[model samples]
Target: MSKAEKTKQHIIEKTATLFNTKGYISTSLSDITQATGLTKGSIYGNFENKDEVAIEVYKYNAGLLGKTLSRSFSDEYPKALDKLHAFVDFYRKNWKFVFSNGGCPIMNAATEADDSFPALKNQVKKSFELWMSKISTAILEGQKKGEIDKRVNAEQYASLFIMLIEGGILLSKTMGDQSFLNHALDKITHMIDHELNILPS
Candidate 1:
């Protein structure tokens, strides 16, 4: 990367947590300058405005979540059933990684960027779809490999799984209790053991 590219990335990385914790509406250019330690001209030189920075920050935060999923799929034995369990296990292991960084970016942005930020709203929507696709792909592989039941609908299960997870995170963050998220993941694990698994539990 060129010097300018590196500088822009430095700004994005520095202010990512601030954007995640503080909504785009509440976060100002001054906040970016404070977090990044960059002058106003430097900030504006890299980004057209706070809105542009927010969009990149959203992508940066979302990439963290993608990494969580990526690691979840990296197993010695990557069966479909195991992958499903890993989905739960990922959040189980990364609760602090997520909660400390101001909760799930898609969830945070989706709730905050409704009528005002169309571009951000679209970004969140695409992220949701991408996450759901990942789940569905795992389910399909499990079904084909005889690890998961063929009768279960992959897309339907994917949506349900995400709904439970996101709801759990929302509650956990709001109540300052990890149990809510843990309980949701526990429920998914149970569903995998009984409803989805073709292997004996």
Candidate 2:
């Protein structure tokens, strides 16, 4: 890549945690300069404004999460049901990575961007839509394979899963207890095995 492209990526990478942790409003130009070791002029040269940088930082953080979760579904999770279980288990396995990166980017952004940052809020909404679509598609695929119950509402289940997981994350993070998330995942697993899973004759 070109020098400018590399520099822009560097800024994004450097400021990702700052933006996620400090938030859009709280992360000042001075903070960006300090985090990226770039002067204000240099930062503006790369990004149109603080808002642009914030948006890009959000994308960078959220993209890393999306890519990581997508990577969880490999040959080990060939079956749709297996993929669902893997999805639930992924949070438990990767909690360290998530915590290190400043919590779930989507959830963090959603909570902060609701009314204040319209642009970032829109991105968060899109991220959630895409996430829900992925879950619903998986449910649909499982139904086609006769592994999931046809009676299950794919969209509803997808929404429910997000609600449980996000809420669990919020509670767990607030309480400094991982058991909340663990309990939520356990409930999801039970729902999948009993409510969604189709028993073989």
Q: What is the C-alpha RMSD of each candidate to the true structure, in Å?
A: 1.2, 1.5
Model 1 agreement with the true structure over 1-201: per-residue lDDT tens digits:
999999999999998899999886789999999998989999889889889999999999998788778665566538878778877988999888899999999999999999899999999999999999888988898888888899999999999999999999999999999999999999999888998998658
lDDT (10s digit) by residue, model 2, range 120-196 = 99999999998898788889988999999999999999999999999888888888888998999998999988999
Report lDDT (Cα) of residue 131, candidate 1.
90
What lDDT does candidate 1 reach at residue 198? 88
Instruction: Tell me the spans in candidate 1 whose CA falls farther than 4 Å from its real position.
Output: 74-76
Error of 1 at 189 (Å): 0.3
**lDDT for predicted candidate 1 compared with the true structure:** 0.89
Could you tell me every candidate's TM-score relative to the true structure? 0.96, 0.96
